[model samples]
Target: MPLIYAKDGAVATFTIDNGKVNVFTPEMHRELHEALQDFVADPMIRVGIMTGAEGRSFCAGDDIKTPLPDLTPHEALEAHFFPHIHEGRTGLTRPGWEQDVMRFKRLKPIIGAVDGYCLGQGLIYLLLLTDIRLATPEAEFGFPEIAYGMAGAGGMTRLAALIPQAVAMEMLLLGERIPADRALSAHLINRVVERTGLMAEARAMAERIAGHPPVAVRLEMEVTERALDMTRDQAVDYAATLFRFQRVAYQGYGAGTGFFGTKHEAAE
Candidate 1:
């Protein structure tokens, strides 16, 4: 299988192993969508770690060697107007996996371990899918689609949201690869480590997240992602509502005294 999904305790690991650089195909995208669905539905899985199978690359992006299928005019129109209708069918349109993955209503947090080339679709996944990221010193990050006369709309939009406009524009317009250290400086990745310790660090972070209250962790993820588009007052109000709901549903935490905890009350 090009994509491998495995579970260890509360942690789920997704490894992309298509080729030396782990370029994705339509089949791989379908597999990834199924894997993410499984992860979201499985109550036992609390956190996820995504990486390439080998140390060569996290992912180089889509496989250019794969031939594009010839589509009829009607099929092309269906592809544009009703993409999800072709979910089980392939070759007629670009798969809607990107939107499906990003709009997951109950997505668990995913940590990215990037070792080498993370360009094009790979960079898009890093920007939108994963919550925390670790990269090796030799890792390279960029959007190479612009050079080929493609806009790479997915990566460009998400990258601009994450980093400054100037940096995002430079990357999108020039198609230049950024080194791991440069990526870290730009706040694109969390840390730059040796290839040997990359997965280890990622796993450790996943485990730490898994140890937290699952509902609280999920609440944090939802609030933060949604808050990006919310006004400050709206964000605070939304968080307060969710916080109350979680406390009521989970019976609170921290020595059974609610989110404030006994220590906080004692100090008060």
Candidate 2:
């Protein structure tokens, strides 16, 4: 299997299993979307951890060796205009990139556990989507699409919001690999651990998140992402509204109360 999904307690894990570099093939992309769909559907799942199979790489991005679909201009236009006409070749009505972006939005607290060689779209996997990113010291962060005369789509779109414009521009324009230390210094990743301890750290973090009240965690994710576009005053009002909603909907469950009504449950 190029992609594997497994669950342990409240935490779901998705592993990219293509050997060594774990390049994203077309099938892998499809599988990823399916895995995320399953994750979203599984009510037991509260968090997800995405990592490459035990190897020196998280993912090296797309496999350039895979041959591109040979579609003529008219066929391509027709495929774009009427997806059902070319559903067999294209797999779905929506492009994989858009599907992936939506999948990312739906998954709560998806953690990217990068070990090595997180490049191109692989880097975007962390930058744009993942809520928490942890990497090993030997990990590499780069956007090498420029070398192939291609431009990145998702990563470039959201990079400036996550990191400084100058730094994001450097990575996008230069097509150079930055070391994990540099990435950490630039605040691109949350933490960098030794290679041997990388998965342990990531799993520990995921377990901690899973142990939290799922509703509160998800609400925090929703508010943070949505608040990015809101003005400060608007965000403050929105957050207050969410606070009331949480208290009402969750019965003050996550307001630091204890299990079995041991701790004082705040009155509504």
Maximum-lDDT candidate: 1
lDDT of 2 by residue, 1-268 (tens): 7889999887888888887998887677777877888898887787889898986489898887876566678877876656446657655443344345434558378889998799976777666657888988889988989888888543555887777889888988898999998998888998888888887888888877777666667778878888999999999999889878877766655445532122223110
Measured on C-alpha atoms, candidate 2 has an lDDT of 0.76
Compose the digit string of candidate 1's lDDT tens values, residues 1-268: 9999999988999999988999988778778889988999998888999999975689998898876565678876776666566655555236445555555555589999999899888888777779899999999998989889888654535777888879888988898999999899999999998999999899999987776766677789989989999999999999999999876665544453432333333222
Most accurate candidate by TM-score: 1
State in Å the error of residue 121, model 1. Answer: 0.6
- Kindly provide the TM-score of model 1 when superposed on the true structure, using C-alpha atoms: 0.88
- For all candidates in order, the CA lDDT equals 0.81, 0.76
